[model samples]
Target chain A: MQTVKLPPLFTPPTPDSPVPSVPFATPLPDIHVTLFRNIRNAVDVRNLVIKGDPRVPECVLINAATIVDVFQIQMACTKALLHQQQGIMRTRSLYSEILFNLSPTNNISDAIRQFGISDTTTAVAVVMVGMQAPPEEVRLRLLTLIEGEPIPLSHLPEFTDLPLINRIYKTGNVAADRGQTLALVVGAMALKGHLS
Target chain B: METHEAILIKQGAEARVYKMPFGEGRCAIVKERFKKAYRHPVLDEKLTARRVIQEARCLQRLRRAGVDTPTVYMVDTPNSLIYMEYVDGSSVRDYINSRAPMNDDDERLLAQSIGKSLAVMHDLDIVHGDLTTSNMIVREGSQSLVLIDFGLSMVSSMVEDKAVDLYVLERAMISTHPDTEGMFQCILDTYGKSSKGGKAVRKKLEEVRRRGRKRTAFG
Candidate 1:
């Protein structure tokens, strides 16, 4: 499990300047990423998210193999915060926005299909963002929701499918170096909606 | 409201650049395009939003084409903010100014690399509207030149636009750094050898330079 505290997306309202053009939640929540391998109930977990079960925290379940680096998740979370702040999120929920932000295209269904879990997906990375509940409490709840062994995020690269990720982002001729690949992928994600 | 510290690094006419803490002990640059009070509110919003998207698009487009540019982390169009990789390097403007007598080999290498980068950008039809020594950085260790500040960048296949881009850099170099005529010539030679439409652009550059001189003389 890895926890990252993101900086606020907007400046706080000051006494002299009482209101901002866009109001944001008082404090943004930290992002928690937990990796699970050899999942026994991948289908059940997907169904819970699809069914909008309250037990599921505000989180997105990503296929661990598609994650090139942990920074990718961090970038998506940052974008999701901005989307939520502006109320311009294309998806129904903030959780879905995080998943959609990871995609290189604007199609919500296509993003879910590519990054979401499947019955054969043995490894999954659960990304929880902006939850009022404590991380440990969420982790305990997640253990019940997902029947799998918890692994540290450092082991994520072991499950990373580099070729698949490159194909998805269409990064041609870029060396297989981790930093280089991550840069291109993150660039693609940032430019998704604005790409001509 | 929770307030995190963001140090103001630069303030320009269009935007303000801040250095802020990002994920996992890393620092990223945040460029915010403030609203212009001189323009109508509705027109200002539309213009600022377009510039924000345009800058982000060019940065990504050049990065995909294998040019060394700041990696964009996020773009908040509604708020007119762009979060990008913080380059920990000295700008070419500073690098040149700091060296009293710049080394011949270093200057030649820097010119060659800058030319190559510009060639790649031009081949992709990316016209860096504002090209100057201050906009280019020499990365600390790798010594590769990384372009920054794409607020005025655009996509155009016109030879005239490409020539004008080079002309802007030429005028900037001449005004800012002394005795850089030879270095500028070296850059042009490398660019001619590397870019596909280099010959036409070079010819157009000559015409542009002549026109520039004529305007200055008339003024």
Candidate 2:
């Protein structure tokens, strides 16, 4: 009698936790402007160019830490952060890095396998933003986000404890509106100049 | 290996082409790899893999979208091999040239067909980086046009970039084929009729054409 052998099931490897790399920490140089006629749809992947810094040029997935690093310099994620049927933009000042997003399609390991974006296009730059909060709360929200588990709004301590902190969720493809992205950049820079 | 000796097919810059046996002499092309010293080993592997994946993806997308390209039977990235359907047809260039003293109706029909094909590609926002007549294969009497070579294809949604791609093709045709102006005009006319952003593209193309004319005049 012949015995049957089953094929091995495909298992994706997990992503490496972001280790602090001594990146070439220079300031952003260019202030390229993008004009927009469609103000309503300006946030659509319309006007933004996500350019990664020297350490990670030509990749779209901006690591959360990297986002934090850039955010410290006041750069923000031009592309909308996506969760299942949701688009989020954080105004936090504590912890920053790429979201390491869970896929909308239920292939749990896909995020870890690809580093973040399915197509980590190098032609675009991904910026990170960060801020300060209790380590546990930040970690939990993020873990839930990446794990793609349904951790409700109340589970996030900031959202529950502080009414000032808002967690906004909208269902759509989060894309950059070139005009708005440029406007934000210009506004931030002008504000920074005023502060200086 | 012995199939090439039996069938005598020519090799390419990167891969050797041969008519070979696939499950007891059911016809297939065997593509053998050639080495590149310039690129690093890891990079080379990644590039080959990406190209194979991209071609397969582009073909699938085109096939799904009803655009014509050969079916990819096999892809061995490690070996840099891609076995595709060998189109039993003449190139659009040959077919165009062979028809001596081509009339306006013939030119317009060919151009319209080309435009429609391009419109389909542009609608999906796939930039065919190398759009040339040589890349397009056709039947003997120009019954149909099948676009080949996804070597430089990339997914993009920029209207400006798409315009630039068409503009590049326009320049290429102008340089290669004699009096391609009327043909291109017809192609553009057809393209304008089909594409959603035709008005914007037409405006962009005019600006591009102006720049081209300036370059020519300066040169």
Candidate 3:
């Protein structure tokens, strides 16, 4: 007589525990950036440019911590600057888009006006989005575009527009710590399109 | 997809959840909807994309309403994945089951919190399609319960829908927890008093229960 073997029962694992890692998709393109401080003529740079005009020299300042979180999404390569090569987001520079990225709303004009580079922007952080260019090459290009002193990212908090960011993202009551605020910001940005 | 690693957490029939590396030091939960073999490719993609968006949006709206839920970290529609905050907590089901002979007041407080959260969501016109203790997590340290898994959730305000939501929770409670009659009753009592339309909802819930009983008896 032939005997049939019973299949093993599927025991449900504890939902909160970590499971094994599966194969992932392609790796992110390498990114390298340099920060510049004491940028001269920021107001002049802001004023010389016309709205919706891409021909003017680009000098946009962005929040360092915020931008990093924005780029970590699986489909963010299309939206954030980290995935694009230099000169790709020229029409709406990466600097401006990064600012727009911070705002939960979709009004590009308001975002640009509030979060984009301003005359008061004395410090700037520049990162290679998805480009293959060397750091020195990119740094020189940025230096020539807007005159500034290269500074480390640590000094970014002193220069970041926290009040404006708070106003834009409506995260003032989220938490006192900057890290928690950043987490809230990341969650906000990720849920941008899904918000009812 | 790059340097960072995402450890698989659970693989339900609908999606595979993973604990992914998020902002420095913080970890995020990534829910990826794997392609279904039964459905057509295009249909599956569309359905998955829609569900991901719906789930993320619901969490966002709930948070805005001050309802306790996970914070969405990122939504990759093209990839059919939702990256959100990994809340550290134990499911109320396990919490109650393992820690039995529990404090009556604490249990009642948790049940009240669940009732209140549900009331708030209903007021906001959001429905938690699957309402069970398993889906509600009691956060570590804070001892607050958070609602998770919004894949089947939707925006609806119909009285029947609301009644059904509560009815589902009641049934789940009966089957999962021992001696939960008091807990479930407390939920209904608190829920009825929590909102302006709570009385109406309780009345409707009775009708739903009667209909459910009829279906079960006839079938």
Candidate 4:
């Protein structure tokens, strides 16, 4: 389990709350990521996402093999937050926006198809954003939803589909160093919609 | 307006740069173009939005062309904010000022690198409108030159545009650093050798220098 606390950039406009609110003191919510391998309920999780199940938190379920590093996820999460802040999300939900932000293209369906979960997926990375549940509670809840062993994020490299990622990102050669590949991939994702 | 803690590092005429914490204990530089009260709201919004998109486009294009640039993290269009990688290094301006009487080899090396990068940039039709020592950073360990501040950058394949770009850098170098004519010459020599259309741009640069940046209809 890995947790990334995204610091707030700006205070949200104060709503008409019954309690008096401080002018500029809202702490932005954090994003939590948990890796699961040997999953048996990928189809079920996908179904939940399709149905927009209330049981699921505001989260994005990604095929862990497609991820190059944690930084990639962090970048995607940051983009998603920006999209949400601007009220310009292309997808129906923030989770879908995160998944969309991870892809190197502007097509929403294509992004989901590439990064979203599949029926045969054995490894998954669950990214939850701004959840009120504690980390332990979230992990336990995820165990109920997904029949898999929770693995540390450091083990992600072992399951990474490098060839697939390279093809998707068009990162030139296979021998490219991890740092270079990561930079190229992140650059592609960031430049998706704005490419001219 | 949800507010997070961000330290304002630089307040320029166009944007306010903030060093904010990103995820995974990393930091990102956020450039927010504040709203201008003087201009009409609609025009200001359109202009700011266009510049933000243009800046991001140029940075990504250069990065794809294998130029060392700060990786863009996110662009907030509504807020006019561009989040980018926080380059951990000093500006070329500071580096040059700190080094008292740099050796010939060091000057040559730096000139060659700058010339090569500029060549690549111009070859890609990117005119870094405000190229200067202050806009380039020397990375800490690698000592690689990373270009920054694409606020005025644009894509134009015209020889005149490319020439003007180089002229801007030359004038900036002359004014900012003392006794840099030899260094600028080295830079131009390397650029002429490396870039595909460098010869044409160099010829045009001579004309640009003679005319002093702006072209006159009478001339």
Q: Which CAPRI category fits model 2?
A: incorrect
Q: Candidate 2 chain A — worst ten consecutive residues by lDDT sum? A: A161-170
- CA lDDT, candidate 4, residue A175: 27
Residue B10's lDDT within candidate 4 is 76
- Alpha carbon deviation, residue B60, candidate 1 (Å): 0.6
- Scored against the native two-chain complex, candidate 4 gets a DockQ of 0.39
- Residue B190 shift from truth in candidate 2, angstroms: 1.1
lDDT of 1 by residue, B139-185 (tens): 88878799999988989999989999999999999999999998999
The best-first sequence of candidates by DockQ reads: 1, 4, 3, 2
lDDT of 4 at A130: 71
Would you give me the overall lDDT of model 3? Answer: 0.65
Candidate 2 lDDT over B97-177, as tens digits, reads 787457888888889988888888888888888788887887544377788777678888877767877888788787778
Model 1 stretches astray by more than 4 angstroms: A12-27, A54-58, A130-137, B213-219
Off by over 4 Å in 4: A10-27, A52-58, A132-137, A173-175, B1-4
Which lDDT value does model 2 have at A137?
53
Judging by TM-score against the true structure, name the best candidate: 1
lDDT of 2 at B216: 45
Whose lDDT is greatest here? 1
lDDT per residue as tens, model 3, B108-177: 8987998898888889888889899999999888777789998789888787788888999999988988
Candidate 1 vs candidate 3, DockQ winner: 1
Which 10 residues in a row give candidate 4 chain B its minimum summed lDDT? B1-10
